[model samples]
Target: MSFKTILAVVTDQAHMSDTLAQAVTMADALDAHLSVVCIGVDRTQTGYYYAGMNAAVLQETMNHAREQAAELATAAKKQMEMSGLRWGVSEAVCQLADMSRYVAAHARFADLAILPRPYGDDRGIELEAATEGALFEGQSPVIVLPEGGAELKMPQKIAVGWNESAEALRAVRSALPFLIAAQSVHIVVIDPPKHGPNRSDPGGQLSQYLARHGVKVEIDVLSKTMPRVSDVMRRHVSDMNADLVVMGAYGHSRFREAILGGATRNMLETSEVPVFMAH
Candidate 1:
């Protein structure tokens, strides 16, 4: 019911400091153990470009990646040493193809995973892979920080983006700890179906469920003013001044979301507030 363990995945050095600060702050706030995984991605794979290249090129690339990963791990450990929280740091030097697997191995052990938003211009391929690994392979809820990293506050006002899908149900369950602790929780449903269980009352069933868990919630049944569902959800979160948003990731398949563009993909790319997601 509570987060006792948290995993933070970091790759590039540019985001290391901010990402670690965010992770440490959350861990301190929740009294949870922090696990830092620093990955130095080796994109130099054996392919057509390297078909005629020397073996030394591959060896050198790998050694450089390991060195970088070790340095990042050392820096992270040094920072966390004075954090006064139970923490550990590990480094991985892996090829791009193997990044997700490595991330999943560590993410599976934690109650929740913290990640930097992997959609901006500065984002790396490894970060995107790590996110997919945590959500799909690790089967853990993830809190993705904004581009510049937000002031890691304990979520006082939380917003839930609801639809009648199993993914949404699972997301609500995963975010129970935060919802229980928040001062106010809002369940926002945009153009809910008129024939489902909640036909007469869109968010009534969910409100009752949360009430049993000692969470008072308000329901907002909104008509989508913008073209995309994500647009309406984003505006609602901003207007409510919610510090955090909880929603299911990729109600459709990942491939479909990537190609056809769904709400989950849009939110990931543009939400200013931290997004808590699970799939």
Candidate 2:
């Protein structure tokens, strides 16, 4: 029901500071225990399979990977020490293929996972792997923070994007703690279906459910003027000044989203505010 244990995934040293600061802030706000995991992806796996690979070159490459991981672990320890929150630090040096598995193992024990935005300036294959691992493999709710997102205050106004899918329902349930604590919670349903229960009431059911959980709930049913669902959702977030967005991630198969471009992908690529997501 509450975030008592939080996991922060760090793949590189450059953005580690901002990532940890965001995690620490969330832990401090929720009085949660913070678990930091630094993942060092060994890029030498490709060369290791080469028939003519040199023994010394392989050893040097492996050593470099471990050293990078060690540096991140050291940095995490120092930051966590100064954070003054109940925390722990761990690190791993694994092949790129295994990065997500390592992250998922750590994520399984936490109530929620936080990761740097996997896109933009510092984007990497490792960051994308970490995000997928936490969301799908670990089966946990995740918060993806934008650049300098460490500066965010505890979310007050929240927006929930609803489409009546099972994924949407799960996301709403996972975000219950935040919704209960938020000053305002808007259940935004875009271009709702014309038939069935939604015909008479679109966000009505969800609003009542949240109200029962002590959420100050409202319904914002709007026509879809934009080409994509995410675009409509984004404008609504801006118009309402919502600090956070809670929504289901990858309602379709990952491949489908990649090829067809679903709302989850768009929101991840473009949202400036923090996105709280669950599969």
Candidate 3:
């Protein structure tokens, strides 16, 4: 029902600032074990296996990278020792050029995963490798931290961006542990469908569902005239003074009449609050 084991990813030294610190704080609060995985260079990515490359040069390059990664991992382990929480540190390398899957595999057993949210212009390969692995591949809920990092506040008022999609449903399900304990939960739906029970009342089904789970639920709907789902959700969260936003992470597709990536990406980039996502 609560997070017992948390996986905090460290892409490099920067991860210490952007992710590991937050993970350590949360782990301390939850009395959980924090596992830090430091990623090493992928031989395939550096073109180290190619024929033209000098064998000595490749050896030197790999050795230097290994040394740097090892030192960073060591530093992280030292810090974790002072975190006052059960903790462990390990290292991994990208295999088959699929860092995302590799990263997700590392976090598969964790109760929760925390990773950085890269801005639109900053969508580098490393970002996807670090995030998508857990968000898409792992079963755990992922908390995407804001750029430059933000404190994982004691969530009092939580906001849910509702869109009747599989992804949204998964997000809601993954967030049940948090929702059940929240002081207030707002299911904000932008232009809910006008059909069946929705025509008579939107958010009725979901409200009833959460109510059964002992959550104090509120359904806030915005008109279709609203500019965008992400924009309106932000305004509503600000109005509600919510500390966290819960929503589906990349489950919608073009076939679903919604681009799953669009709204999710927007929230990831623009929200000052942490976004909890599940696919």
Candidate 4:
């Protein structure tokens, strides 16, 4: 499906430029509306329970955060205009207690959300939570950019992390727009240990399926040495210099990710390129 509105979640962290650039590029390509969200802390509410800081100090802190958020939105708007893409800028005052919830609420109005992967020493937990919120709560497809990667083009080479699971199949179907646009596509079947009786070769099946849809396709079986499916898929992207990776989001509980931490989260944290994820 074509995306008409794209939401990008930005914060005071590293890799903001890359994330902004990617968002602008996608908006330009799709001629879509872009929304840049800056998540910040609200210290006013925190002062009610804390004894160390007073109302005046908390207000000062919140004021500073608001200034920073405005600056970030301004810079992102400038970048989008520089790229010749028309976009609208938006800012929200959020409390840490419900920041993810706020993001999810805003996402309800957009077609997609672009987020940065979890990395570095300090912001790892926050990134993880935000990404989880985007995937589980937003209930929309998310595009995650790597930590320090270059901007992605039209994704000439695309990799789909395929399994027999319903989620993986849904992701593949949701990514059809990109697949149709990509010059080359690879369907990677991540087989489970101790193959079962009904475990048909997904790679071959998917290749044949896409060929009918006019996508130039290839299949590759990962070696046994590469155990976890997510890790192997990421390694393939790096080795092949793929521009985009597509996979499914897996979550067992509201607060927990399932086995392998889900392909979406794994590639987001470790990939060297862009990843398109859907639940």
Question: What TM-score goes with each of the models?
Answer: 0.97, 0.95, 0.88, 0.86
Model 3 C-alpha lDDT per residue in residues 160-222, reported as the tens digit of each score:
888777888888888887898889999888887767557667777889999999999998878
For residues 1-279, what per-residue lDDT tens digits would candidate 4 score against the true structure?
677888888776465677888888888787888888876556355436576866688778788878867877777777667776667777766666667787788677777788877554545355665676676687778888876777755678998887666766777777777788889998876654356753555466677777887888888766645656678888787787788888877634433543336455556667888788877
RMSD after Cα superposition, model 2:
1.6
Task: For candidate 4, give the lDDT of residue 221.
Answer: 65
In candidate 4, the residue pairs with backbone N, CA or C atoms under 3 Å apart (3 or more residues apart, or in different chains) clash, namely: none
User: Which candidate number maximizes lDDT?
Assistant: 1
State the lDDT at 170 in candidate 3: 87
lDDT (CA) for every model shown? 0.90, 0.88, 0.77, 0.73
Name the better of 1 and 2 by TM-score. Answer: 1
- Displacement of residue 103 (Cα, Å) in model 1 is 0.6
Residue pairs with colliding backbones in model 2 are: none
lDDT-wise, the better of 1 and 2 is: 1
Question: What ordering of candidates by TM-score runs from best to worst?
Answer: 1, 2, 3, 4
Q: For residue 149, what is the lDDT in candidate 1?
A: 48
> By the TM-score metric, which is better: model 2 or model 4?
2
Per-residue alpha-carbon lDDT of model 1 for 76-130, expressed as tens digits?
A: 9999998999999999898998888889888898999999997877888788889
